[model samples]
Target: MKKLLLGSVCGLGLAAGPALAADLGVPVRAAPVAVVVPGFSWTGFYVGANAGYGGGKFDYPFNAFQRQLQAEAPAIESRLDGRLGLTSGGFILGGQLGYLYQFDNRLVAGVEADFQWSGIEGRLSGTGTLTGTGTLPGTFSLDAGSQVRWFGTLRARLGYAWDRALLYATGGLAYGQVRSHADISAANGGTPIPGLTGGVATSHTRWGWTVGAGLEYALTQNWSFKTEYLYVDLGTSNVLSSAVDDPGNGFSAGASMKVTTRFHTVRAGINYRF
Candidate 1:
C-alpha cells in the first residue's frame, strides 16, 4: 500500500509541472534593432527665386560737355555746368542657382549666380536762355533720364553656420544693362530750330563688382529662406549728343556725357536643396 501511494504522488507532480510550463508559454530572444538620428547639413545644390526692392544712384556728369561748349559756345557754358544726380527705386524679381559646402568647424562656403529684372528709373530736366552777343538767342532745354533694365551677379559666399541658420558675407562680379537718354533743343522766338535739336539714346551692358551680407534660415532639411542686402557698382558709360548747323554754316558742337550707375538692393528669397 505505501509503494502504490508514493508512485501516484510522483505522477501527479509531473503532470502539474507540464501544465504550469504550458500556461507560462515558451521563452523568445528578441532580434536586434537599429536606431537612427537625423542631422542637418549644408552640402548641396540649390535653386531659388527672389523678390524685393532695388534703388540706387544715376550720376551724370556734364563736365566734358561743359568744357567743350565753353570753348565752342561761351554763351551756353553756364547752362551746361549743371550736373545730374538722380536716385531711382523700383521692384526687382530674380532667380538664383548655387552650391554650398559646410566644414566640420562650422564654416560654410558656396558659389552662386543670379539674374534680376529691374525697373529702376529717374529723369531730370532744366531750361535756360542763351542771350550772349555771339550766341544764337534762344531758349535751351535739357532733358535726361536713365533706367536699369536688368542685372546679374556671380558671387562667392563665406559664412558661419549655427545648426539651422547661417550668417554670411559675399562679394563678386556684377553686370547689368543700362539705358540713358538725353534731349537738348533750342527755340528762337517761339519757333523750334530744326538743325539745333539734338538727342542721344544709349544702351549698354556694363560690368563691375558687388558686395553684400545675408542671413539664411533652414526651414527644413531641404528648404531655406534668406534676407540679403547688396551694393552694386556697374561703372560708367559714355553718350554723345550733337547739334549741327545748316548745310552752309560751319558751327557744329557735340556734348559728351558720362553716366555712372550704382545701386542698393534688399531682397527675400526661398531655396530648395538637392
Candidate 2:
C-alpha cells in the first residue's frame, strides 16, 4: 500500500511542471528597438524675405556749399554760413539668399547676399537774416534733400548656435544708389529777387561697408525667423551747382554740395531652408 501511494505523488508533480512551462513561454518578437531622433542642424542653403525700418544722419558741410557763392557773392556766402544738417528715416523691404555650416561644437558660419528697396529720405530748408554792406540786407534761403532708393549687401556671419537658436555678428561689402538736391534762393524783405535762384540735382551709385548683429530661431525643421540691426556707410558724393549770376546787380556766385550716406536698419525676416 505505501509503495503505490508514493508512485502516484511523483506522477502528479511531473504533470504540473509541464503545464507551468507552457504558460510562461517567451514572446515571438523582441521589444521594438528604441527610436532616437537627432538634434537640429544649421547647415543648409536658404532664401528669405524681410521688412523693416531705416533711419540716421548725414554730413553736409556748409562750407562746401558756400564755395559756389564765395567768389562773386562774398556777402551772401558769409550770411549763409553755418547752415543746416539733414535727418533721414523710412521703410525698407527686401529679400535674401544665404548658405550656412554648423560645426560639431555648435559654432556656425555663413555668407549672405541681400537686396532692398528703401524709402528712407530727408529734406530741410534754412533761412538766414543778412544785414551787411553791398548785400541784399534781407533773408537768404537754402533747400536740401536726399534719398536712398535701393541698396544691397554681401556679408559674412559668425555665430554660436544653441540647438535651435542662433546669435551672430555680421559685416561686409555694402552698395547703394542715392539721390540728392540743393537749392539757394534769396529775397529782399521776403520779395523774390530776379536771377537769384540756382540749384543742383544728382543721382549716383556708391559702395562702402556695413557691420551688424542678429538673433535667429528655428521655427520648424526647415524654416527659421530672424531679426537684425545693421549700420551701413556708402561714402559721400559731391556735385557743383549752377552759379548765381545777375549782370544788372553785378552779382555772380557758384556753389558745390556734398551728400554723405550713412544709416541704421532694423529688420525681421523668415527663411526657408533647402
lDDT of 1 by residue, 58-173 (tens): 99886312211334555342224446888889989999999999999989999999999998888889877745444446677878899999999999999999999999999999
lDDT of each: 0.83, 0.82
**Candidate 2: clashing pairs of residues:** 68-254, 68-255, 69-254
Worst 10 residues of 2 by lDDT: 63-72
lDDT of 2 at 144: 87
Whole-model alpha-carbon lDDT for candidate 2: 0.82
TM-score between model 2 and native: 0.77
Give the runs in model 2 whose Cα sits over 4 Å from its true position.
1-27, 64-83, 129-139, 186-196, 242-252
lDDT for position 102 in model 1: 95
Models, CA RMSD each: 6.0, 5.3
Q: What is the TM-score of each candidate against the true structure?
A: 0.76, 0.77
